[model samples]
Each structure stands twice: as C-alpha cells, then as structure tokens.
Target: MATYKLDCNGGSGNSYKLALYLNCAGLDWQPIGVDFAGGQTRDPDWRAGTNTMGEVPVLEVNGQRMSQSGAILIWLAETTGKFAPAGTVERFEALRWILFDNHKFTNNYAMHRFQVSLTAEPVHPAILSFLRSRAEASCAIVDKHLMDRPFVLGERPTIVDFSMAGYMYYPAEETGFDIETDFPALHAWRQRLAGLPGWKPPYELMPVGSSPPVRVVTQTA
Candidate 1:
C-alpha cells in the first residue's frame, strides 16, 4: 500500500481536484491540512520549506513532493496505470481541455467565487460582473462539449473530466452559478462523476470548512 499525503484546505477547488482523483482511484491517502485561511502560504519560510511556489494540494509520497494539480494528476495516472487517456489522440485531447480548464474554466469561476463569497472586503461590482461573464462564456463551451459526450473524451472518464469537474461540485451559493438548472449537460456530467467509487464532496474529505475561506485570497508582493 502506497501512503499519500496531500496538503490542502477545504475551500480550495484546486486541492479538491487531486483529492477527488485520489479517492475515486481508490488510493491510500490522507489530506494534510494547510492553514490557508491564516496566511500560511504567504509566508516565505513556509514556502521555502514546503512549496517554493506557495500553493496547497502538495502531494507527498515516497519522499517526493509534487505541486500543480494538473501535473500531479497526470503523474498519478501514469504511476497507477489508471485514467491515463486511452492513446495518443486522447492524450492530446486531454491536454487541450486541461489547458482550457486552467486558463478559463476553473480560473474565471474561482476568481468570481473568491470575490463573491471568500474575500474579506466586497469586490467592485463591475469586476465581479466581468469575471462572472467570462466564467459563463467558458461554461457554455463546456456544456456544449458535454452534450455529445458522456465525458470530455467520450463515454469513459479521464483526467480531463477530473480537471474540468474541479469547481462543479461547489455550491451555487458559493460559486454564484447553479449548473443543476443553468447548465444541464455539465450538471449531468458531474452527477456521473459523483456516482463513481470512493467519491466524496470537497469539504467532506478535507478537515476544514468551506465558508469564509481558509484565508482572504490576496496577491503576494
């Protein structure tokens, strides 16, 4: 049995991405909580000692530490020989969708949700509106893509599904968008992912609360 430790907080969709994969794959792992709500990642010492990039969802296993959710997901699939995109064509296809997810699908939505539900101070309504619109546009593309496929690649679930489904499980009140009614295809896709073995919602697996954020999201100077 391989032991895996993931550094994370309950409120992080990025962290949840890895958590979801580990659970669904039936791996032996536990979440190592990071005090993200307390400016822990912002500290230079913590960054130097843990992750130089200063982010959570650090996967520690067999004396190796890995960051970046996308990279780690690929590594896990490769090492375990599970969910490793069927072939060359599917691999490229997975890469394309994962890039889109990181750049827009997850990024825009996370920003919008951070501003609306996590920030200590209210964000300007105009900025919020812009982010919301961008998120919606990206969501529309994903919903359309899912309309003809059960998963991103086809009938089978892959890393692309995990990457894109990162924020879909969060509450509408938190994300400010309800896929259940607003994006039927996306909702159905996530429902399918949820039914897989070892699946658990983000907060239920992590040792923290989803509200008020682990810490007020801020840019480091």
Candidate 2:
C-alpha cells in the first residue's frame, strides 16, 4: 500500500491541491478516485465512513483519514519540511494566504466554474454573477500582492502557493476567467509554480473523465 491514499474527485480543485503537493513533494501516495458525479460521495454510508463533511481529497494515512486541503497541506509541510514557511513571520503569512484562498480565492472561483462549466443543470444568472464578482475581487487582491513576488511568500514557493493554485490550472473556458489578461501578475506567478519539479496539470494527476487532458498553457508568454 502507498504511504498515503488520497480519496479524490477528479473534478474537484480541492483534490488537485493535495495531489499537487504530494506529487511535488515526491511523496509515496496513491489517488483513490471517488465517483462524485455518481452521487457516491453524498451517500450516507460514504459520508459516515469517509468524511462526515462530505468532501473529497480526504487523505488517508495508516487508515486514519484527514480532510480539508489547507489542514492537510499544513501537515504535509510540517512533516516533510519541503514547502514550509521559513520563519515565524512567514508561517503566519502562509496561514493568512491559505485562509484567504479557502474563503475567497478558490471558494468563489471553484463555485463559479462549476456553475459556468461543470454543472449539468443551468445555474441562475444572478448566482453566477455573484460568484464571478467575488472570484474576480479575490483574484485582483492576490494579483496585486504577487506583483513583486515570485511566489506567495516572496522568493520561494510555500504550501500557500499550493493552496492558491488549486483551480488555476484548469482551462480558461472552464474557469470563465482570462487570468492572463485580467490578472497578469497572478498569471506569472502560476507560471513560476508550473516550472517547479514534478509539477503536473490537474487532470493528468487524477482520474477525471474520458476527455483528453487539456494542455496547460502558462500565461507567461
């Protein structure tokens, strides 16, 4: 058995976050595909047995399950000491970014994407507009912050980068955001991240659909 097993839905950006970290860290991990579209995750038995929160990207180590990408990323950082913040100040900074990501960045962005591209049912325009506005505001904040830095913590990548990068790899059509033009600085930072060793686009790292993997074109060019 792999040292760690990740229960993931290929369509979930949250799942991509943990998978990215594991791959980049060179951890001995396996991706256990979850049939989220089939309503498996929401099944009572699955929720009680896997995650009461009813979420994917549940990390299992020695049969002990851990959910929530930010918490799992922190644990992995502390355990591997690979992408951990270097100092107390950096640690707090990392935490700040991580919280912002979960609350504003990935949260709104992922919701907007699902409504716009993934959902089989039509989403109300008012709802999509609300999510889009929130996502754009969050992207603007991070873009401005990253204007002068190579990574979230300044010169180096941290777990915060991994957290924020969750949905950035998906196609612009799916995300409904032209990050390259709308958030130039953020686009550059994403390229820097993609340049890291062992980096792979989300679909390539998980079992998603029969559709071929969309080539990730970093907006740097």
Candidate 3:
C-alpha cells in the first residue's frame, strides 16, 4: 500500500476536491490541517517542506511532493486506476477540460470571490465589475460545455469533473451567481456529482463570532 500525506485547509474548495477523491479512491492517506484562518499555510515549515507557493491541497505521495489541485486530481485518478478514461484521445480530452478549469474558470471566480466578495476593504468599482464580468463569461463557457454531457469527460465522472466541481460551486454560493438558474445542465451535473458515494461538502462557512470549526485528522498506516 502507498502512503500519502495531504496538507490542506479544511474549508477550502480545492482542499475538499482532493479530500473527496482520496476518500472515493479508498486510499490510505494522512490529512494534515493547515489553518488558513491563522495563516498557517504561510508558515515557514509548510512552505519549505510541502508547497513553495504555500497553497493548500499539497500531496506528498511516496515521498514525492505535488501541488496544484487539478494536477493532483489527475495524479490520483491515474494512480488509483479510476475516474479517467482508457483511450488516448479520451484522456487528452479530459486533460484539456481540467486545464481549462484551472486556468479559466477557477481564475476568474477566485478574483471575484477573494478580491471582491470576501475582502475587508472596499474594492474599486471598475475592478469589481471587471472581475464579475470575467466570472460570468467563464461560467457561460462551462455552461455551454456541460450542456450535452453529465460530466466534463463524458457520460461518467472523471478527474476533470472532480477538479472543477468545487471551484464551480464556490462562485455559485459566494457570489450569488445562481448556476442552477442560469444553467440547468450544469446544475444537474452538480447534483449528480454530489450524490456520488463518499461525496461531502468542504466545510460549512462559520458565522461571525462562532467557534472555530472542527478539523479532521487522517492517519496513514
């Protein structure tokens, strides 16, 4: 059996995507909590040892360190012999959508959510409008791609679906984008993905003044 170490912040969508995939794959791995609220990801130890960029969902598999949620998802899927198609063309297609999600959808949504919605300081009107517009355009592209397929790869779920789902869902909730209202196919895809075995939401966003959320610890034997 291969042992893996996953360093992550519990509430982050990217972290949840990896967590869900690991669970679904029935892999033996350890989940090391990084407290984003306390800037634990920026800690020297985590940055040097796990991710130089200090990003969450960094996976250490058989002593090889890996970062980036989409890359990790592809690695896990290929390693576990699940969630990826067999043919070369099919696999390439899956990879293309995965890249699109990371480069296109996630980028725009992050700018809107973090820079505009979640910040303490006021955002400039021009910048806010630009981010929102970019986010909407990205979602429209996703909506079009998902129109005929239940998953990004095809009829069945794949690493691309798992990798993109969390990022897609984040904007829907944080930005009040209403994906279900605007894109029925994509909305149904979300519902289908959520119904999969071992599916779980990342973590509930805590209300103001609430106690800190409980962290889950995983041990690899």
Candidate with the greatest lDDT versus the true structure: 2
| RMSD in Å for model 1 | 4.2
lDDT of 1 at 160: 82
Report residue 206 deviation for candidate 2 (angstroms). 0.6
Model 1 agreement with the true structure over 1-221: per-residue lDDT tens digits: 44998989888889999988988888899888788877888889989888999988799999899999988888988899777797899888888888999999999888888887788777787888898899989999999999998999998998888888788888766777778888899999999999999888988978652236433333311
Report, for every candidate in turn, its global Cα lDDT versus the true structure: 0.84, 0.86, 0.70
| Candidate 2 lDDT, 1-221, residue by residue in tens | 89989998667889999999999988999898888777777789999999999888899998799999999999999988979998899989989989999998999898787777776555677887788899899999999999988998889888999999999998887777899999999999999999999899988888752222333322211
Error of 3 at 180 (Å): 1.2
Q: TM-scores across all candidates?
A: 0.93, 0.92, 0.84
For residues 82-113, what per-residue lDDT tens digits would candidate 3 score against the true structure?
78666899888878887887787877776666
Model 1: residues >4 Å from true position, as ranges? 209-221
Of 1 and 2, the candidate ahead on TM-score is 1
> The CA-based lDDT of model 2 is what?
0.86
Candidate 2 lDDT at 134 equals 90
Q: Order the candidates by TM-score, highest first.
A: 1, 2, 3
lDDT of model 3, residue 100? 83
